[model samples]
Target chain A: MRIFFYSVQSEWLKTKNSIASWLCLVGGFFIPLLYLIADIKNKTFINSAGTEIWQTHFTRLWMNMSGFLLPMGLILASSLITQVEFKNNSWKQVHVTPQKYSTIFFAKLAVLLGMTLKFFLFFNIGVIIAGTVPCLIFDHSFPKENIPWLYFIEKNARYFIACLPIIALQYLLSLQFKNFVIAVGVGLAGLIGTFIAFRWQYIYLSPFSYTNPFAERSGFSENILLYATIYFVVFTIISFYLYVNKKIKG
Target chain B: MEYCVQTTDLAYTFSNRQQVLDNVSIHVPEQCIYGFLGPNGAGKTTTLKLILGLLRNHQGTIKIFNKPIAGHRVEIMRSVGSLIESPSVYGHLSAKDNLRIFQKVYQCPQGRIDEVLSMTGLANTGTKKAAQFSLGMKQRLGIAIALLHHPALLILDEPTNGLDPNGMVEIREFLKLLNREHGTTILISSHLLTEIDRLATHIGLINKGRILFEGTAEQLKKEKNRETYILYKTSDNQAAAALFARQNIKPALLPDTIKIAATSKENVAGLNRLLVHNGLDVYEITTEKNDLETIFMNLITD
Candidate 1:
């Protein structure tokens, strides 16, 4: 367990100047900054009731996030994190370390998961900033409705759960193939396939469809989060198997 | 003798069914520089990879420090450090940062990083990202990383592959000093025999996936010396050849000298005595031994 911790720490150092780190910070604030601009320009919050204002704000935020940004962000983030080793031509170096293949695999996966968590943290903070800036600039009274902190937490947690399978699968692709284009290309194709099949009765069977349906509450079953968890586990297990059993890692 | 690394009948086939190694066995003794000499594509890197456990599902066993590498790979690897092919480094990070990552993995003290940096002559390269490093600098950083944990054995594949003469000399000196001072057993591979010929105490020559020669450097020399020829200049070269012919010993007669196949020093002495007894003054009897390159070429080519 201590060795695994060390592996995770080492893996995190590899991302110091990498694109994945930039993706996390920039991706978090990208949408909220645009929304902030639009709200301030239009005075959208000057006369709204507190509850109505809060509801509208969350709906707009979650709509973009769960529908497009989160999935695509995950696809890019996972690939970027895994490709750091390949880009540096250091896979053989990592493999020759005293750590086991399991340690290296899980440590990298943990860092990817942590990057997603960071993105969400920054996004939530950005959401709050976006909501308050317009009210302050327009000299409007602050919303009287209590911040629905529990609701925000639950929704973010659920969406994060829904995106796990995508993260695992993309990580698998990135680790298995050294080419950056192939991993991201396959991920983009999967996202497009989900949109084309969005209306199908069994579209929920695809892990890519997990985020949009869970957020909109339109097509997927109430057990969609559980299904996402299952897919994540299955993909993770398969990734570990392929990684450990790989004949020529270097 | 106790061995630092030993492999027996190890074989590997690629996914395309190409046999890269066939019944290749190597033994590296403790605290000695075992030079793995081979031409390119002779399975040197593949063999090293299998021994390092980077390649899996091989045909035979690898025992390092007398423990099988199969079940005890991680445990065994704790005492083994390797730099295979190119240096493994993150170009965006400085040499210090690159070593820090491995230090954390190896769980060594922070001070060891500085030790290896200076050991590899990289202590002055502060804040310079590895990408900006020269090939020799990158190679040195790789060696520093390998030595960070103070492993008992270091496996380096062509550590001097793309270096200038000075760079190669520096690496060679560093390795010799490491072996002498720290008792670190080194298994260095190179395609150029001359590169390791002066550095290696023992040698294992590989070609076409088979080990053509495995023994001490002195023994390799002796193998070449077995075909020595004696060229002697006498007062009468013609009579000198005729004197050996009477004893059923054929000598090649030249205008100035007689050349005879040398079986031993005793035989050479007897031939010289025969010349002098035949009223021919034996002036020079020089034994010509084949050079190492010739012997290496002859062994591998055949």
Candidate 2:
């Protein structure tokens, strides 16, 4: 366990100087900033009374990402994580270490899962700043009373946790294949597939549809979250098993 | 013999049904330079990877430091440093960062990073990422990473593949120094026998996925030197050749000397006595040593 955390810290360092990582960070700030600028410019946002504006904008924010961008974004971020090792030929470097493959595997998976949650936190902060611009600029008051901190955390954290299976799937793809386009291409195809299966009663059966439950409604769906959690557990097990047992070919 | 690494009846087939390694058994003794000499696709790197636990599906046993590699991999690998095939590094990272990655993994002291950087002669490469590094620099960085933890054993596959002659010589000298000063057991592999010929105390030759030979370099030289040839220079080269032909042994007469094929030093001495008794002056009888390249070529062909 000590080695596990240390490996996790080392895994995080891979992204320190990466431009792709910086781009992903900028995305967290950019998405909400774009949405807020558009929302604040609209007359309907100005005419709306009280928490309705926050609710509508927040719903739109999660929906836009949860529908396509967040799923694809999670795919991109996960691919980037494995990309560093794959493109750099660092797999052999890591494997020759005293640390077990299981430790290294979990450390990377945890970091990607952590990044998924991080974007959520930053996205919410972005939303908060941009969402409240009108309240402060036009209404001469902060939207503190209007912003649901608990609700924001609850929803963002829920959606983030719900996206685990996707992250795991991406990690598996990236591990299995060397090229980033194939992983991201498969993910984009899955994102498009989610649109077709999203309204189905059993949407959570698909890993990509986990975010839909959070985005389509105000609260979490017990059945879909339950299903996503089960998938997360299964994906984690299967991916780790394959990673440990599979031969690393040069 | 106390062996640092031993593989018994190991064989492997790829997913595409290409069998890369076939019943290969190689033993590397402790505290010596073991050369894994093989042609391309001769399973040298595959064998190294098996010892490192990078490839798990194989048919036999790999014992490293007296422990079965499958069972005590992490513990066994803790004392091993390896550079398999090409240098494994994050090209996006600076040289220091690459060393730092392994240093953190091995949990070595923080200051050891600088020691390795200076040792590999990359201490002055500030903020220069590995991607921008020259091939030789990357190779040195790989060695630095392998040397970071100060492992008792170092397994390097084709360590001098991309190096210039001077770079190769420097690395050879550096490895010799490491082995001499620190008593580090080095297992290095290469397709070129000359590369290993200069450094290897012990050698294992592989071809077509099987180890053709494994022994000390001197042992190989002794086996290679089995056939003795003496170049006999004489006052009368033709007279010496005719004298040897009288005994039904043909001697190829050159301009100033006659080449005689004899089994042993005693045979050459007897021939010298016989030629001198036949009114011929034996100026010099130089014994020919079979070069390693010839022996290596013969082994591969056989």
Candidate 3:
């Protein structure tokens, strides 16, 4: 366990100056900053609809985010973070370390998950800033209801869960292929294919279709999260098998 | 003798069914500088990779510290540090940052980072990203990381490939110091005979997916000295040859020189005196012995 923790820490350090780090900070802030600008310019806070204003703010944020940016951000972030080893030609070094192959595999996957969570943290903070800044700028009467903290947290957690299959699949692709374009290309094509088949009766078969349904609160089975969980587990198992049994890692 | 690293009949074939190593076995004695010498594509790097557990599914077993490497790889690797083929370095990180990452992984003392940096002559490279470093500097940084944990066995494959002569000398000296003072066993590989000849106490020479020689450097020297000859440049080559012929010594005549297989140092001296007594100007009488390069060629061709 100590070795595993150390592996995770070391893996995190490799993310320094990588494109994944930039994508996290920028991906998190881009939507909120755009919303803040639009809201401050339009002065929508002056005609607030009580508690619904908070719901409206979060809904719009998730709508724009979950439909496109969230899945794409995960694909790019996971690939970039995983590719750090390949790009630096340091996979041989990583493999030669005293850690178990399982530890190395999971430690990197954990770091990628942590990066996603950091992206969420930054994006949520941005959401708050976007929500409050317009009211502050125009000095309009603030919304008359308390923030729905529990509701927003629940939605964010669910959306994060929904995006897991994408992360796992992309992680697998990046680990198997040294070329960045192939990993990113396969992920983008999968997401685009999900979008094209979104209206199918059995669209729930695809994990990528979950985030949009969960965000819009429509077009999904009640077992949607369960299906996402199953896909995440299946992909993760396949990834673990490939990584540990890999004959030539470095 | 207790060996630090032992491989028995280790063989490997690539995915394409191209065999890279064949029945290659090497024994690196504890606390000795074991040089792995071979030409390019001589399976040197492949053998090193197999020993390090970077390449798996081989036909033989590797034992480090007398324990099988299959089940105890991580435990064995804790005491082993390696730099295989090229220097494995993260280009964007500074030397200090790079070492710090490995330090956390190895869970070694933070002070050891500075220790290895200065040891590899990279302590002055503060805040300079490794990507901007010269090739030699990056190679040094790679070596520093390998040495960071103070492992008992250091496996380096062509560690001197990119270094300037001065850098190479420093690394050679540092490796020697590491082995002598710390009792660390080293298995260094190189294609150049002179490179290994200066440093190796023991050598394992490989070529064409096979090990041709494995023994002490002195034993390799004996093999090189098997065929010794003498060359003579005189004021009169014909006169020197005529003198040798008269003395019942067959000399191979060349352009302005006479060559003969040397039987003993005393006989060479006697021949020189005979030339001088015969009123011939023996401008040069040079005894020649085969070097490791020639020995390597002979081994390969054989």
Candidate 4:
């Protein structure tokens, strides 16, 4: 436990100057801000379905982010974290420490997990802040009374859970390759694959589509979580194995 | 001598089936500087990485501080420090922050951050990111990170590589200080004979993934003597030759010189005085210098 804390702390030090972390945070803010501006523009031009604008807007926000930006952001975040190690040639340095190689791997894994969680935080909170502002500025209903808090939490939970396969796959890819482009390339390719899978009505089967808002009806499907968990477990095992066993070139 | 590091019949081959390290064994004595000398691609860095547990799959045995490295690596590495090849620097982090990363991993004292910075001459590099650091500065920071925990053994692979002359000297002096004051056993590798000559108390000359020679510098010098020749330039080359013959010393006579065997220092000095006594005008006496370069070449070629 002590080593784990120290490891995270140490990993944090490695990233203090990295631009990737800031980009993830900015991505969180950027998504909502875009949604807010569009919401304002839409309210001004079109008047209709006045029952619950917040739901439509919130769902839109979730769709774009969970579907496209969040997964992409997670991939970039994992790449950035590993980039600090490989780009700097710190792999040999970190592995040489007295700590166990497995311990070191898990330590890095923890930091990546923290990054994933942090991304989710920014995305979720940005939605609220961005969602609330339009209501205040345009005199639209806040939708606070009808907002299902449990459902909201469940939706975010399901989205995070469903995003597991992608988080694991990208994290594993990032750890395996020293060249940043390969991981990023694989991720971008995976993003495209998700869209193609969407038309086949099997997008939920694709880890990339779990957080995809277009596939929201199937987001909480048991098979989606089960598949996500399976990929998460499998890829995570492969990542740990590679990290602990692969002969790192100095 | 107490060996701080020991490896026996150690070998490694890459996935491509190219042998990176042959059957190799190296013993680094406690508190002594063991220079691992080899040319580029000779597997010096690979060997060090194996010893440091940066890579695991290998054939044979490696023991650190008398403990087998296979299972006891974590415990053994607690007393070991290493810097392999290029300096490991996060270009975005400051020198202080870079040190902090290692300091935290080793669970070193909080004050170690400042202490290592000052020690490595990076104390004033406040918030200056490592990307802005020169190669020399980056190397120093690497050394500082390695030294922060004050390990009993330090394995450095060409630590002074790419440093200016002054920077190299500073690092050489620093390693000497570490050995002298802190009783740190050092195993440093370099292809530069001059650099190793300056700091190494013991040398393991490796070529093509095998140690060609391993011993003290004096032993290498003795190896040097066998192939050395003494050359003498004189006014009376024929007279010097005749005189050398008379004294039962063979002389190779050239147009302007008489070259005699200088098998030993005492013998050379005695022969010079004898030639002077024999009325041979010995204008110049020169002995061939069999320095490390010649010896290293001989070892590799042979």
Candidate of highest DockQ: 3
lDDT of 3 by residue, B227-284 (tens): 6668999999998998999989899898978988777789888999998998988889
Q: List, residue by residue over A1-250, the lDDT tens digit for candidate 3.
A: 9888999999899888778998999999999999888887877762374557777888878789888898999999989987888887899998889999899989999999899899999998998889888888888766676778998889888888888999999999999999999999998988899888787778788868887744245556577778889999999999999988889967
* Model 3: residue A221 alpha-carbon error in angstroms: 3.7
Candidate 3 regions with alpha-carbon error over 4 angstroms: A46-50, A213-216, B230-261, B264-288
Off by over 4 Å in 4: A39-56, A135-149, A201-203, A218-222, B231-286
- Sliding window of 10 residues with minimal summed lDDT for model 1 chain B: B287-296
> For model 3, what is the alpha-carbon lDDT of residue A237?
93
Per-residue lDDT of A166-230 in model 2, one digit per residue for the tens? 98888988888889999999988887787776666665567887776343462336565676778
lDDT of 2 at A78: 88
Strongest candidate by TM-score:
3
Instruction: Give the range of the ten consecutive residues with the poorest summed lDDT in model 2 chain B.
Output: B259-268
Interface RMSD of each: 0.9, 1.6, 0.9, 1.4
Candidate 1 wrongly placed segments (more than 4 Å): A46-52, A138-146, A213-215, B229-289
What would the per-residue lDDT of candidate 4 be over residues B263-285, giving only the tens digit for each residue?
67787778778879877777888
DockQ of 4: 0.66
- Between prediction 1 and prediction 2, the one with superior DockQ is 1
Model 4 scores a C-alpha lDDT of 0.81
Q: Which ten residues in a row have the lowest lDDT in candidate 4 chain A?
A: A44-53
Q: What C-alpha lDDT, on a 0 to 100 scale, does residue B161 get in candidate 2? A: 76
Q: Which scores greater on lDDT, model 2 or model 3?
A: 3
lDDT, candidate 3, equals 0.88
Q: What is the docking quality class of candidate 1?
A: medium
